[model samples]
Target: MSTNFCETATRVLDIEAKAITGLKTYINQDFNDACQLFFNTRGRVIVSGMGKSGHIGNKIAATLASTGTPAFFVHPGEASHGDLGMITQSDVVLALSNSGETEEILKLLPVLKRLGIAIIAMTGNPDSTLAKLADIHLCARVEQEACPLGLAPTASTTAALALGDAIAVALLEARGFSADDFALSHPGGSLGRRLLLRISDVMHDGSQIPLVDEQATISAALLEISRKGLGMTGVLNAQGQLAGIFTDGDLRRILDQRIDIHQTLIVSVMTRNCVTIRAEMLAAEALKIMEQKKINALMVVNAEKVPVGALNMHDLLRAGVL
Candidate 1:
């Protein structure tokens, strides 16, 4: 029984895969026209459909909205009651129906026409009324349903969804949508935290910064590093500018050379002109610099190159950037 079940599942996957592959033939002038219309629209793309098609439409609208194209899904059954008012003349309608003759969707056509809203229809039947009425018609035709009984909308819906993704991606590329732009739409996600989190947001600032004068002895710098627990400290010159940095690694080297911590000036033993990042730079950018420099800590500097803040890898890990 298990073997039979596995075979059935594999058959379903094969049929759906073929259905998605067959959609490539329909990526012609009609698809291009549909994308052009969607891209040029100043208002939102209003997506509508019935039943399973409605579910697919909702996801497509979300993908479009998140990827630089503004869109929303309005159920056709609800649109016939009162939701039709949500669509405006400036908005473009993207209607989905496998047979291209869904009654609830058909009921909205006259009202949509009177409003002068452009319609783009995605259907398996090109000769159907919905396709005939649309300004652009995309053929999502598939040979057969993945369902063994040929009763459920399986392969057809998968084809329609893939086609929707293709359109969304094409529009995303045409608009030059970037990862930072995507992060703005999803600020609550991990990618947003990585891209939008500035060094100022995560770095130790003001009194929390581990800093010592360049003229201070290595013992004083070590005391600051111990107090701050950042495993490092910044050595500033008499002019209040960043002169050098002293880290745990630097301490290891100094100890190897038997330099007396009480007698050596920090400027004489510290790393001169260490790598620094801007306060406004992203924390992810800081992580890249730390990895490249083979260091665990960095000093955040201002436009004038004065050390303003400090952070270590632990801060990044705690902030969910790592």
Candidate 2:
């Protein structure tokens, strides 16, 4: 028999998309109650399930943990042997069972209840035992499966996953979870670099900073710029405070002026009131200044306006803030 692959794929997508949309109707008072339970829980959220529901539960637990609610996944089958010790009286259990009658999850229900641990059940059958036993029953009911055989846990799992995300976001909002808090949890990511990396962390300080005396010649300034390799040098006053900055752009502007680099002092041609950044500011903020002012580098100064550090686009690029 001939089969249309694209048509079947399209039908599957349509079914799954509808399954996600169908979850909106299930966002009732039960959803709010579940969020309240998670928000108030001093201990972690323990997500337990069997089979494909187990995989979905694992992801749900991770989402909750990352978004501000503390959670982790535990296999219900394992809970019976010794894993039940992991669930404490302070924790809450989010059990996943599509039929609301998984033997493995149901087996742990008694222990969970005995410990006075709250059970939030996500199931397709509200009349099922798991649902009846739960303290909060979240209806993740789906109209049908995307599988043509109508036996697999396709649409049902999709609906449940969406509901889990909704619960996570609701709790995140309730806790006033901010982007900086998320970046802290996810420090290895690009967002973490952009948010957590400060100018002091990435800027070159001490002898690495290119500096020249205000009375120094252009040739001396160029030597400092090339030696430090930051494409610029801060012109410092006799008090060792920043006076102005000389960049490669200034070098180009003076090229045709017939002024001798050996004779012309740096202070004569340096850009006054040059853009600067503080060491405590975010590296991302430094990038914004560079982009807006159309410059490649910044001299990090202190409250005394002394140049303590130097950074360029290359520094930001290396720090993964660009």
Q: After TM-score superposition, what is the CA distance of residue 83 in candidate 2 from its true location, in Å?
A: 1.8
C-alpha lDDT of all candidate models, in order: 0.94, 0.93
Give the runs in model 2 whose Cα sits over 4 Å from its true position.
1-11, 176-197, 213-220, 235-246, 249-275, 281-295, 316-322
lDDT per residue for candidate 2 within 1-322, as digits (tens), equals: 9999999999999999999998888888998888899999989999999999999999999999999999999998888999999989999899999999999999988788888999999999999999999999999888999987899999999998998999999899999998778877888878889989999999999899999899999999999998999999999999988999999999999999999999989999999998899999889999999999999999999999999899999999998997
| Colliding residue pairs in candidate 1 | none
Writing each residue's lDDT as its tens digit, candidate 1 over 179-254 gives 7898889898677889789999999999988999999999999999999999999988888899889999989887
Q: What TM-score would you give candidate 2 relative to the actual structure? A: 0.79
What is the total number of backbone clashes in candidate 1?
0
Off-target runs (Cα >4 Å) in candidate 1 are 4-22, 143-146, 176-184, 187-196, 214-217, 237-239, 250-273, 287-295, 320-322
Point to the candidate with the largest TM-score: 1
